[model samples]
Target: MINRKILARVAGVGAAATVAMGLFSTGAANADTFVPLPGGEIVKTLSDGTVVTVRLVGESANINPSLGSTPVHRNAWVSGSAQVELSGTGADSGGRIFPGYTVGCQVNIAGGGTSGGVDGGVAWEDGSPSIGASGGGDLSLGPGQAQSFYILDLEQADDFGSETHKKRNVFSGSNGSVTWADSTIGLSGCGGYAQARAFVSVEVETESVVTWITLYGQPFSIG
Candidate 1:
Protein backbone atom coordinates (compact mmCIF):
# COMPACT_ATOMS: atom_id res chain seq x y z
CA MET A 1 0.00 0.00 0.00
CA ILE A 2 1.19 3.57 -0.72
CA ASN A 3 1.57 5.90 2.23
CA ARG A 4 -1.19 8.43 1.58
CA LYS A 5 0.30 10.77 4.15
CA ILE A 6 3.39 11.21 2.06
CA LEU A 7 1.38 11.22 -1.14
CA ALA A 8 -0.81 14.03 0.15
CA ARG A 9 2.21 16.17 0.91
CA VAL A 10 3.28 15.91 -2.72
CA ALA A 11 1.36 16.71 -5.89
CA GLY A 12 1.38 14.79 -9.14
CA VAL A 13 3.54 16.41 -11.80
CA GLY A 14 1.73 14.95 -14.83
CA ALA A 15 4.85 15.56 -16.88
CA ALA A 16 8.27 13.95 -17.10
CA ALA A 17 10.76 15.87 -15.02
CA THR A 18 13.46 15.12 -12.46
CA VAL A 19 11.87 15.44 -9.03
CA ALA A 20 13.01 15.58 -5.42
CA MET A 21 10.08 14.53 -3.22
CA GLY A 22 11.69 14.62 0.18
CA LEU A 23 15.03 14.28 1.92
CA PHE A 24 15.06 12.21 5.07
CA SER A 25 18.26 11.54 6.99
CA THR A 26 18.70 7.83 7.68
CA GLY A 27 22.36 7.99 8.67
CA ALA A 28 25.46 10.12 8.30
CA ALA A 29 25.95 8.93 4.74
CA ASN A 30 22.65 7.24 3.88
CA ALA A 31 19.98 9.79 3.23
CA ASP A 32 16.91 8.54 1.35
CA THR A 33 15.22 10.48 -1.45
CA PHE A 34 11.59 9.97 -2.28
CA VAL A 35 10.56 10.83 -5.87
CA PRO A 36 7.01 11.46 -6.91
CA LEU A 37 6.91 10.95 -10.65
CA PRO A 38 4.48 12.42 -13.12
CA GLY A 39 3.44 9.42 -15.13
CA GLY A 40 2.40 9.89 -18.80
CA GLU A 41 -0.30 8.97 -21.27
CA ILE A 42 -0.62 8.40 -25.02
CA VAL A 43 -3.47 8.15 -27.49
CA LYS A 44 -3.33 6.79 -31.02
CA THR A 45 -5.76 5.95 -33.77
CA LEU A 46 -5.05 2.81 -35.70
CA SER A 47 -5.62 2.41 -39.43
CA ASP A 48 -8.67 0.35 -38.69
CA GLY A 49 -10.32 3.25 -36.91
CA THR A 50 -9.71 1.85 -33.46
CA VAL A 51 -8.54 4.31 -30.84
CA VAL A 52 -6.14 3.23 -28.13
CA THR A 53 -5.13 5.11 -25.00
CA VAL A 54 -2.53 4.06 -22.47
CA ARG A 55 -1.68 5.80 -19.23
CA LEU A 56 0.86 5.50 -16.40
CA VAL A 57 -0.36 6.94 -13.14
CA GLY A 58 0.31 7.01 -9.41
CA GLU A 59 4.04 6.58 -9.89
CA SER A 60 6.66 7.17 -7.21
CA ALA A 61 10.08 5.93 -6.14
CA ASN A 62 12.28 5.93 -3.02
CA ILE A 63 16.02 5.79 -3.52
CA ASN A 64 18.96 4.69 -1.36
CA PRO A 65 22.17 5.64 -3.15
CA SER A 66 24.59 3.42 -1.27
CA LEU A 67 22.98 0.16 -0.38
CA GLY A 68 26.08 -2.04 -0.36
CA SER A 69 28.39 0.26 1.65
CA THR A 70 30.10 1.17 -1.60
CA PRO A 71 29.65 3.72 -4.36
CA VAL A 72 28.72 1.05 -6.89
CA HIS A 73 25.53 -0.12 -5.20
CA ARG A 74 22.08 1.46 -5.23
CA ASN A 75 18.54 0.49 -4.33
CA ALA A 76 15.08 1.93 -4.95
CA TRP A 77 11.44 1.08 -4.34
CA VAL A 78 8.99 2.05 -7.14
CA SER A 79 5.25 1.97 -7.66
CA GLY A 80 2.79 2.86 -10.43
CA SER A 81 -0.41 1.99 -12.26
CA ALA A 82 -0.99 1.33 -15.98
CA GLN A 83 -4.39 1.82 -17.48
CA VAL A 84 -5.54 1.08 -21.06
CA GLU A 85 -8.76 2.02 -22.73
CA LEU A 86 -9.96 1.21 -26.23
CA SER A 87 -12.79 2.63 -28.26
CA GLY A 88 -14.43 2.29 -31.67
CA THR A 89 -15.31 -0.89 -33.54
CA GLY A 90 -12.21 -2.91 -32.78
CA ALA A 91 -11.01 -4.26 -29.42
CA ASP A 92 -12.03 -7.81 -30.21
CA SER A 93 -10.33 -9.45 -27.23
CA GLY A 94 -9.21 -6.43 -25.25
CA GLY A 95 -5.46 -6.14 -24.72
CA ARG A 96 -2.31 -7.26 -22.94
CA ILE A 97 -0.38 -5.09 -20.50
CA PHE A 98 3.37 -5.54 -20.01
CA PRO A 99 4.71 -3.09 -17.45
CA GLY A 100 8.47 -2.83 -17.08
CA TYR A 101 11.41 -0.50 -16.36
CA THR A 102 14.89 0.14 -17.70
CA VAL A 103 17.89 1.22 -15.65
CA GLY A 104 20.98 2.83 -17.08
CA CYS A 105 24.47 3.76 -15.95
CA GLN A 106 25.80 6.87 -17.61
CA VAL A 107 23.57 6.22 -20.60
CA ASN A 108 20.66 7.98 -22.26
CA ILE A 109 17.20 6.43 -21.86
CA ALA A 110 14.99 9.46 -22.26
CA GLY A 111 12.43 9.47 -25.03
CA GLY A 112 12.03 12.15 -27.70
CA GLY A 113 8.97 13.59 -26.00
CA THR A 114 6.69 12.86 -23.09
CA SER A 115 3.55 11.16 -24.41
CA GLY A 116 2.60 9.51 -27.76
CA GLY A 117 6.20 8.53 -28.52
CA VAL A 118 6.96 4.82 -28.83
CA ASP A 119 10.73 4.67 -28.42
CA GLY A 120 11.81 3.41 -24.95
CA GLY A 121 15.65 3.42 -25.39
CA VAL A 122 16.15 -0.03 -23.75
CA ALA A 123 18.30 -2.69 -25.63
CA TRP A 124 21.88 -3.11 -24.47
CA GLU A 125 24.89 -3.33 -26.74
CA ASP A 126 26.53 -6.09 -24.65
CA GLY A 127 26.72 -7.73 -21.21
CA SER A 128 23.18 -7.79 -19.90
CA PRO A 129 21.67 -9.64 -16.94
CA SER A 130 18.66 -11.94 -17.01
CA ILE A 131 16.39 -10.45 -14.35
CA GLY A 132 13.82 -13.27 -14.67
CA ALA A 133 11.80 -10.10 -14.52
CA SER A 134 9.32 -11.69 -12.06
CA GLY A 135 9.67 -8.71 -9.71
CA GLY A 136 13.41 -9.16 -9.06
CA GLY A 137 15.47 -5.99 -9.46
CA ASP A 138 18.97 -7.10 -8.44
CA LEU A 139 21.40 -6.23 -11.27
CA SER A 140 25.13 -5.81 -11.95
CA LEU A 141 26.12 -3.20 -14.50
CA GLY A 142 29.02 -1.11 -15.69
CA PRO A 143 29.29 2.37 -17.18
CA GLY A 144 27.62 3.02 -20.58
CA GLN A 145 25.26 0.09 -19.98
CA ALA A 146 21.59 -0.55 -19.28
CA GLN A 147 19.01 -3.35 -18.82
CA SER A 148 15.27 -3.95 -18.76
CA PHE A 149 12.87 -6.12 -16.72
CA TYR A 150 9.20 -6.88 -16.30
CA ILE A 151 7.53 -6.53 -12.91
CA LEU A 152 4.90 -9.27 -13.05
CA ASP A 153 5.31 -13.04 -12.76
CA LEU A 154 1.84 -14.47 -12.56
CA GLU A 155 1.33 -18.17 -11.80
CA GLN A 156 -1.48 -20.04 -13.47
CA ALA A 157 -2.44 -23.58 -14.47
CA ASP A 158 -1.87 -24.46 -18.07
CA ASP A 159 -4.13 -26.50 -20.33
CA PHE A 160 -2.77 -29.69 -18.80
CA GLY A 161 -3.08 -28.27 -15.29
CA SER A 162 0.66 -27.62 -14.99
CA GLU A 163 1.63 -24.45 -13.24
CA THR A 164 3.22 -21.73 -15.37
CA HIS A 165 4.25 -18.15 -15.07
CA LYS A 166 3.34 -15.12 -17.17
CA LYS A 167 4.87 -11.69 -17.38
CA ARG A 168 1.86 -9.80 -18.69
CA ASN A 169 -1.78 -9.27 -17.79
CA VAL A 170 -4.58 -9.84 -20.30
CA PHE A 171 -7.86 -8.01 -20.27
CA SER A 172 -11.13 -8.49 -22.05
CA GLY A 173 -13.65 -6.00 -23.45
CA SER A 174 -12.21 -2.53 -23.95
CA ASN A 175 -10.31 -1.79 -20.79
CA GLY A 176 -7.23 -3.22 -19.03
CA SER A 177 -5.28 -1.95 -16.05
CA VAL A 178 -2.47 -3.07 -13.72
CA THR A 179 -1.08 -1.55 -10.54
CA TRP A 180 2.18 -2.31 -8.73
CA ALA A 181 3.56 -0.86 -5.52
CA ASP A 182 6.97 -0.98 -3.84
CA SER A 183 8.79 -2.89 -6.59
CA THR A 184 12.52 -3.01 -6.11
CA ILE A 185 15.16 -1.73 -8.55
CA GLY A 186 18.60 -2.82 -7.40
CA LEU A 187 21.89 -2.00 -9.10
CA SER A 188 25.58 -2.50 -8.50
CA GLY A 189 29.05 -2.15 -10.05
CA CYS A 190 28.55 1.34 -11.43
CA GLY A 191 30.27 4.00 -9.36
CA GLY A 192 28.87 6.80 -11.49
CA TYR A 193 25.50 8.52 -11.71
CA ALA A 194 22.64 6.22 -12.72
CA GLN A 195 19.05 6.65 -13.93
CA ALA A 196 15.86 4.64 -14.49
CA ARG A 197 12.50 4.94 -16.24
CA ALA A 198 9.24 3.04 -16.61
CA PHE A 199 7.42 1.78 -19.69
CA VAL A 200 3.98 0.41 -20.41
CA SER A 201 3.80 -1.89 -23.45
CA VAL A 202 0.30 -2.91 -24.39
CA GLU A 203 -0.88 -5.17 -27.21
CA VAL A 204 -4.36 -4.46 -28.37
CA GLU A 205 -6.20 -6.68 -30.85
CA THR A 206 -8.86 -5.44 -33.21
CA GLU A 207 -10.90 -6.75 -36.09
CA SER A 208 -8.42 -5.47 -38.64
CA VAL A 209 -5.15 -4.95 -36.85
CA VAL A 210 -3.02 -6.36 -34.07
CA THR A 211 -0.53 -3.81 -32.88
CA TRP A 212 1.72 -3.07 -29.91
CA ILE A 213 1.83 0.39 -28.35
CA THR A 214 4.21 1.56 -25.64
CA LEU A 215 3.77 4.48 -23.24
CA TYR A 216 6.94 5.97 -21.80
CA GLY A 217 7.20 7.38 -18.30
CA GLN A 218 9.49 10.17 -17.12
CA PRO A 219 13.10 9.18 -16.56
CA PHE A 220 14.47 10.10 -13.13
CA SER A 221 17.85 9.91 -11.46
CA ILE A 222 18.52 6.93 -9.19
CA GLY A 223 21.28 8.59 -7.24
Candidate 2:
Protein backbone atom coordinates (compact mmCIF):
# COMPACT_ATOMS: atom_id res chain seq x y z
CA MET A 1 0.00 0.00 0.00
CA ILE A 2 1.08 3.66 -0.61
CA ASN A 3 1.83 5.82 2.34
CA ARG A 4 -0.52 8.81 2.10
CA LYS A 5 1.44 10.60 4.83
CA ILE A 6 4.59 10.53 2.76
CA LEU A 7 2.62 11.53 -0.31
CA ALA A 8 1.24 14.49 1.64
CA ARG A 9 4.73 15.89 1.83
CA VAL A 10 5.61 15.56 -1.86
CA ALA A 11 4.39 19.02 -2.83
CA GLY A 12 5.54 22.24 -4.52
CA VAL A 13 8.06 22.58 -7.31
CA GLY A 14 10.73 20.66 -5.40
CA ALA A 15 8.40 17.80 -4.62
CA ALA A 16 6.55 17.79 -7.90
CA ALA A 17 9.74 18.07 -9.85
CA THR A 18 10.79 14.84 -8.22
CA VAL A 19 8.28 13.12 -10.48
CA ALA A 20 10.30 14.01 -13.58
CA MET A 21 13.68 13.61 -11.95
CA GLY A 22 12.98 10.13 -10.71
CA LEU A 23 11.80 8.81 -14.09
CA PHE A 24 14.74 10.20 -16.09
CA SER A 25 17.63 9.50 -13.77
CA THR A 26 20.75 8.02 -15.37
CA GLY A 27 21.02 5.24 -12.82
CA ALA A 28 18.07 3.24 -14.09
CA ALA A 29 18.44 0.67 -16.87
CA ASN A 30 18.52 2.23 -20.35
CA ALA A 31 18.06 5.67 -18.76
CA ASP A 32 17.18 8.38 -21.26
CA THR A 33 15.49 11.77 -21.57
CA PHE A 34 12.12 12.49 -23.18
CA VAL A 35 12.44 14.71 -26.23
CA PRO A 36 9.70 15.86 -28.62
CA LEU A 37 10.03 15.93 -32.38
CA PRO A 38 9.75 19.09 -34.41
CA GLY A 39 6.68 20.03 -36.52
CA GLY A 40 4.44 17.98 -34.28
CA GLU A 41 0.74 18.73 -33.60
CA ILE A 42 -1.38 18.68 -30.42
CA VAL A 43 -5.03 19.64 -29.92
CA LYS A 44 -6.76 19.50 -26.52
CA THR A 45 -10.53 19.95 -26.00
CA LEU A 46 -12.23 20.25 -22.66
CA SER A 47 -15.69 19.05 -21.70
CA ASP A 48 -16.67 22.70 -21.28
CA GLY A 49 -16.29 23.15 -25.03
CA THR A 50 -12.88 24.73 -24.72
CA VAL A 51 -10.22 23.91 -27.25
CA VAL A 52 -6.58 24.90 -27.43
CA THR A 53 -3.74 24.43 -29.87
CA VAL A 54 -0.57 23.19 -28.21
CA ARG A 55 2.69 24.32 -29.70
CA LEU A 56 5.34 21.69 -30.30
CA VAL A 57 8.25 21.87 -27.96
CA GLY A 58 10.96 19.33 -27.12
CA GLU A 59 9.31 15.88 -26.89
CA SER A 60 10.40 13.24 -24.40
CA ALA A 61 9.16 9.94 -22.94
CA ASN A 62 6.47 9.67 -25.62
CA ILE A 63 4.63 12.59 -23.93
CA ASN A 64 4.43 15.73 -26.02
CA PRO A 65 5.56 19.03 -24.53
CA SER A 66 3.15 20.84 -26.84
CA LEU A 67 0.10 19.51 -24.97
CA GLY A 68 0.52 22.32 -22.43
CA SER A 69 -3.06 22.97 -21.41
CA THR A 70 -4.45 23.14 -17.91
CA PRO A 71 -5.54 19.61 -16.98
CA VAL A 72 -9.27 19.10 -16.58
CA HIS A 73 -10.40 17.05 -13.58
CA ARG A 74 -12.80 14.16 -13.03
CA ASN A 75 -13.89 13.66 -9.44
CA ALA A 76 -10.83 15.67 -8.33
CA TRP A 77 -8.47 14.30 -10.98
CA VAL A 78 -7.13 16.07 -14.03
CA SER A 79 -9.65 15.51 -16.82
CA GLY A 80 -9.61 16.07 -20.62
CA SER A 81 -8.14 14.37 -23.64
CA ALA A 82 -5.27 15.61 -25.77
CA GLN A 83 -4.70 14.19 -29.24
CA VAL A 84 -1.06 13.02 -29.57
CA GLU A 85 0.65 12.34 -32.88
CA LEU A 86 4.19 11.21 -33.62
CA SER A 87 5.47 11.06 -37.19
CA GLY A 88 9.04 10.30 -38.15
CA THR A 89 11.69 7.61 -38.01
CA GLY A 90 11.87 8.17 -34.23
CA ALA A 91 8.19 7.48 -33.54
CA ASP A 92 8.96 3.90 -32.57
CA SER A 93 12.20 4.80 -30.83
CA GLY A 94 11.29 6.17 -27.39
CA GLY A 95 8.47 5.93 -24.87
CA ARG A 96 5.68 8.58 -24.91
CA ILE A 97 4.52 10.97 -22.19
CA PHE A 98 0.94 11.43 -20.89
CA PRO A 99 0.92 15.08 -19.37
CA GLY A 100 0.35 15.26 -15.61
CA TYR A 101 -0.17 11.86 -14.02
CA THR A 102 -1.10 8.53 -15.53
CA VAL A 103 -4.38 7.25 -14.09
CA GLY A 104 -4.94 4.45 -16.58
CA CYS A 105 -3.42 2.97 -19.73
CA GLN A 106 -4.02 0.47 -22.60
CA VAL A 107 -1.65 -1.18 -25.10
CA ASN A 108 -2.29 -2.71 -28.54
CA ILE A 109 0.04 -3.98 -31.22
CA ALA A 110 -0.69 -4.55 -34.90
CA GLY A 111 0.01 -8.04 -36.28
CA GLY A 112 1.33 -9.36 -32.98
CA GLY A 113 0.34 -10.62 -29.55
CA THR A 114 0.22 -8.21 -26.56
CA SER A 115 1.91 -8.56 -23.14
CA GLY A 116 2.35 -5.68 -20.66
CA GLY A 117 1.62 -4.87 -17.00
CA VAL A 118 1.64 -1.86 -14.63
CA ASP A 119 2.44 -2.17 -10.93
CA GLY A 120 1.89 0.45 -8.24
CA GLY A 121 4.71 1.01 -5.81
CA VAL A 122 7.32 3.64 -5.20
CA ALA A 123 9.39 3.96 -8.37
CA TRP A 124 12.98 2.71 -8.05
CA GLU A 125 14.08 6.23 -7.15
CA ASP A 126 11.60 6.53 -4.29
CA GLY A 127 13.51 3.95 -2.16
CA SER A 128 10.35 1.95 -1.37
CA PRO A 129 8.77 -0.60 -3.66
CA SER A 130 5.12 -1.52 -3.82
CA ILE A 131 3.27 -3.57 -6.41
CA GLY A 132 0.12 -2.07 -7.94
CA ALA A 133 -1.84 -4.92 -9.48
CA SER A 134 -5.60 -4.93 -10.03
CA GLY A 135 -5.99 -8.65 -10.69
CA GLY A 136 -5.01 -11.35 -8.23
CA GLY A 137 -3.31 -13.54 -10.85
CA ASP A 138 -0.29 -12.79 -12.98
CA LEU A 139 -1.28 -11.31 -16.38
CA SER A 140 -0.50 -13.59 -19.28
CA LEU A 141 0.32 -13.11 -22.97
CA GLY A 142 -0.34 -15.69 -25.66
CA PRO A 143 1.03 -15.79 -29.18
CA GLY A 144 -0.68 -13.62 -31.83
CA GLN A 145 -3.02 -12.08 -29.23
CA ALA A 146 -3.53 -8.47 -28.09
CA GLN A 147 -3.97 -7.78 -24.39
CA SER A 148 -4.41 -4.62 -22.29
CA PHE A 149 -3.76 -3.90 -18.61
CA TYR A 150 -5.64 -1.08 -16.91
CA ILE A 151 -4.49 0.27 -13.54
CA LEU A 152 -5.85 3.16 -11.51
CA ASP A 153 -3.35 6.01 -11.93
CA LEU A 154 -1.86 6.96 -8.61
CA GLU A 155 -1.42 10.62 -9.51
CA GLN A 156 -4.61 12.59 -8.86
CA ALA A 157 -5.51 16.31 -8.86
CA ASP A 158 -5.93 16.30 -5.11
CA ASP A 159 -2.47 14.81 -5.05
CA PHE A 160 -1.20 18.01 -6.62
CA GLY A 161 -2.40 19.89 -3.59
CA SER A 162 -0.37 17.61 -1.34
CA GLU A 163 3.34 18.28 -0.86
CA THR A 164 5.02 14.96 -1.52
CA HIS A 165 5.06 13.11 -4.82
CA LYS A 166 1.74 11.30 -5.13
CA LYS A 167 2.20 7.54 -5.34
CA ARG A 168 -0.98 5.51 -5.22
CA ASN A 169 -1.38 2.01 -3.83
CA VAL A 170 -3.27 0.51 -6.77
CA PHE A 171 -2.02 -1.12 -9.98
CA SER A 172 -3.48 -2.91 -13.05
CA GLY A 173 -2.53 -5.99 -15.04
CA SER A 174 -1.22 -6.24 -18.64
CA ASN A 175 -3.13 -8.44 -21.08
CA GLY A 176 -2.34 -9.05 -24.75
CA SER A 177 -0.57 -11.30 -27.24
CA VAL A 178 3.18 -11.77 -27.39
CA THR A 179 5.09 -10.67 -30.42
CA TRP A 180 7.53 -8.09 -31.74
CA ALA A 181 6.30 -4.93 -33.41
CA ASP A 182 5.71 -1.20 -32.93
CA SER A 183 2.99 -1.17 -30.25
CA THR A 184 0.70 1.59 -28.98
CA ILE A 185 0.19 2.66 -25.35
CA GLY A 186 -2.58 5.10 -24.44
CA LEU A 187 -3.75 6.82 -21.24
CA SER A 188 -7.24 8.33 -20.83
CA GLY A 189 -8.84 10.27 -17.98
CA CYS A 190 -12.00 12.18 -17.03
CA GLY A 191 -12.95 15.06 -14.64
CA GLY A 192 -11.18 18.43 -14.38
CA TYR A 193 -8.97 17.43 -11.48
CA ALA A 194 -7.11 14.57 -13.18
CA GLN A 195 -3.86 15.33 -15.01
CA ALA A 196 -1.48 12.91 -16.79
CA ARG A 197 1.54 13.21 -19.10
CA ALA A 198 3.13 10.55 -21.30
CA PHE A 199 6.70 10.19 -22.59
CA VAL A 200 8.31 7.93 -25.21
CA SER A 201 11.94 6.94 -25.43
CA VAL A 202 13.74 3.99 -26.97
CA GLU A 203 16.31 3.90 -24.18
CA VAL A 204 14.01 2.49 -21.50
CA GLU A 205 14.08 -1.28 -20.93
CA THR A 206 11.28 -3.66 -20.05
CA GLU A 207 10.66 -7.37 -19.37
CA SER A 208 11.95 -9.92 -21.86
CA VAL A 209 8.43 -10.70 -23.02
CA VAL A 210 8.45 -7.18 -24.50
CA THR A 211 10.57 -7.33 -27.64
CA TRP A 212 10.24 -3.57 -28.21
CA ILE A 213 8.34 -0.95 -26.19
CA THR A 214 6.85 2.30 -27.44
CA LEU A 215 5.81 4.87 -24.89
CA TYR A 216 2.33 5.85 -26.15
CA GLY A 217 1.67 8.28 -23.28
CA GLN A 218 3.58 9.32 -20.15
CA PRO A 219 3.13 12.32 -17.80
CA PHE A 220 5.46 15.02 -16.45
CA SER A 221 5.44 18.16 -14.29
CA ILE A 222 4.72 21.70 -15.68
CA GLY A 223 4.44 23.99 -12.68
Clash totals, every prediction: 0, 88
Whole-model Cα lDDT of every candidate shown, in order: 0.65, 0.22
RMSD to the true structure for each prediction, in A, is 8.4, 20.4
Which regions in candidate 1 have their CA more than 4 angstroms from the true location? Answer: 1-30, 112-121, 124-135
Over 1-223, each residue of candidate 1 has an lDDT whose tens digit, in order, gives 1212111111111111111111121221233788888888777778877777778899988888888878899988888988877777674457777777777787765632323121223432211223333334777778877777877767799999999987777777777688887888888998787877877777766666767766667777887
RMSD after Cα superposition, model 1: 8.4
Instruction: Name the weakest run of 10 consecutive residues (lDDT summed) in model 1.
Output: 6-15
TM-scores of the candidates in the order shown: 0.77, 0.20
Model 2 lDDT, residue 164, Cα: 42
Model 1 earns a TM-score of 0.77
Candidate 2 residue lDDT tens string, 1-223:
1111111111111000011111221111111223232322333232322222222233333232123232321111112222222222222222222222223212111111123223322122221112233331122222222223222234545545764422222111211111111112232232111122332111111221112122323333211
